[model samples]
Target: MSRTIISSNVRSYFASLWTATLYHAIRQSNWIAIAVTGVFSLILFIAAEVSPTEGTWGISKASWLSVCGGVFASFLFLCIQSMLSALKATNRDMYKAAFNELVEKHGIKTVFSQRGSDDVITLYRKLLSSPRRRIWAIGMTNKHFVDQHLESLVHVLTSYQIDLVIAFWDPSTTLIVRQNGGRARSIIEAQSALEGNPGSKWGETIRQRQLRIANAVKDQPIRGDVRIVNVSSVTSFSCFIIDDDLFFFPFLANTDSTNDPTIYCAAEGSVGRSIIDHFTKLLQNSEVCTTTYHQKETTVVVPMT
Candidate 1:
């Protein structure tokens, strides 16, 4: 450990030991304090009884002196005990302040053990069910999210004029979506130690989903004009904002987001707002493409031979 840390720890340890052992060693008793004070008081009483002193109202001088000395010693002990109690309270407040600062620094409210777990999905459903004016996403194709939460999304988006935006990685420039500074692996290099799947193999084009959303918007009471856009920058995380809730997922090597941890925070928090700002910039800088379905897609089936 660093010198400062070790010194602080050592200081804290002694302070605690002093508070506990000298004052509160026994839960229901103060034997040590009583004994130490008793001995000191006895010495004071003895010294005062031997001192030469005057008497008041016919009281013996030695008797009055000893009495005053004993009372003074008792009061001193009481003050010391009170000081220790106050010290403990101060320490507790300091610790609480430190914890609050840590929480503020990260702006994290909850850390879901696993992303896409039952509780996480349930929370998403609940958040979507609420009345909202818009929804935003930053992720890959977002097919997985749509396919998985289609019902909830449709229900919520249709409940009100909650617009949706899906800003996904542009597949053309996403040939290598590794972490920043990650060395590029050859396409021929098979994914082995890691399920190092190439970017192209994932996130299907949003062309079709856009049409579905368009159709819903045309007929549904709610505005479901899902704007699908492409982002050229590489990302190591996916963020989704539902109402005031922000869900952040940092990708792990070869692991699907569903298996990774999820950080949930309020949109107003420092972490959440910063991420939303970045996503807003991504959409603004990239030309957002809005697709309108001219007509229902038709298919001609060949006669079976």
Candidate 2:
């Protein structure tokens, strides 16, 4: 009777151990390792219980079985860890390779040439000539101040017969204008106000202003006309020109409260060169201006002129 009771207790303990191990493995999503360990543990438990010899070499069969079970479990756990490590390494390599390919295919190059003041102008010229779909300029202003600048810009473009559009955003207000006659309002702002009720944060406000500007330019009345859009912040003015047949050009300005005469220009030249190359291949004229200080010296690149 005592022998029977001891054997039953040993079986119950082994059963509980196996159940706990499986529970943990399942929780961790390691089904394969759990299965292997469970089968081996069951086999060890059975061998210990059914063995005819109660004691072999002065050690009980159950004691040896317990030790073997522990070693097997440890080995299986190591195997799972090894598999997970290998998978993680493979994923990391794939991500790196993908990123490198994208950079090679579409990454823009920066042109760093010239020295001192000339260097800055050269950089600006490059940016102005770079081929791009759109450019965005930002600055600072009040309602009347912006209107004055907008009138001047429209007059200049009209004098050149360049098709254009103007978009505006001021907190809860929005407006759009084209040469012929078209107007729209701030849908994004309205939606944002309804859904999130977001307060006036700098980033959010800037984003809203940009969105309104982009929408106005995109929905311009002309089908194939190039767009030159301008906007401002509290301290600066920005200009963006999107030309389908020409390279992109951008002009930025910081209002001189201290009465300084210095102006800065940032241009993407390598992109401009690429665009010129494409046009040259197609036997088309691609004229672009590469200059930093429009006030000091104007550099204009006209087609073979």
Candidate 3:
């Protein structure tokens, strides 16, 4: 084998040996094997002092014993440090292996608690750098996504032709909105004490959410067409698909979707595929959203029938 291969093999062997030694040291009780060597060295010191021999093999007995004991202690100290360093390195490798395993099993890439954070934005910008053919976003209103990502989308639109679809829960008609103790308008007293405020914002239904989409993309993109799929109740999570990456997260009842943990998955993978399939079926059964906007086109409003 070449020198490089031989070096690699040797390194691997030492790494394994060091790791094994560390584990063995951890498993051993206080009566460790190294302590026996220390005891033997102590006995040698006593022998050196007790013996009357001035020298052996032209070396003073006491000095020889002292040198031997010093060498033994130095070697032991080096072994301990090497093993500790090895243990530290192996732990890091174990963490990487575990992370890879999770990614393989669930198609889960990055998982962070806050959505639309700097990390999410950075990831999107990087993804936009690649050649993208299609982009689909799914969520409850998806207002947060549009607010943070529309700038990058505009920039990419100038560069390449991409098919963009924004799928959101119909704010006015979705039953998935917080029922807030399951109290329906008909059941609750119109002027009861329970009605502390006359407003509900689990979703902002004040203006058609499609208006936000329309306005965000109204500035005609020379390349991309933005479409909307307004579904009612299949809104399990907020999802954004840009090419092969699917970004998604849950909707916390009391807080914004941004407060939930967002998950990244490969668009071709199982988790992403299942989500896409559900939306596809919903789109097939879709009605034209209340407010429709495609880049550079006149905004069209469809009355709920």
TM-score of 3: 0.60
lDDT, candidates in the order shown: 0.62, 0.39, 0.63
Extract clashing residue pairs from model 1.
none
For 77-119, candidate 3 gives per-residue lDDT tens digits of 8557656765676677666667776677557787877777889
Candidate 3, which segments miss by more than 4 Å at Cα? 1-55, 102-109, 122-131, 148-159, 172-182, 185-207, 211-225, 268-305
lDDT of 2 by residue, 186-254 (tens): 433332343444343533554444443333333233222332222221212222223322212221221
lDDT of 3: 0.63
Q: What is the lDDT of residue 246 in candidate 1?
A: 88
Models sorted by TM-score, best on top: 1, 3, 2
Encode model 1's per-residue lDDT on 50-156: one tens digit a residue: 75666556777777767767676785776578657656755675566665764566567789978779998888777777756768877756666777766676676
Error at 80, model 1, angstroms:
11
- Alpha carbon lDDT of residue 227, candidate 3? 71
RMSD of each: 8.8, 19.3, 11.0
Q: Estimate each model's TM-score.
A: 0.61, 0.29, 0.60
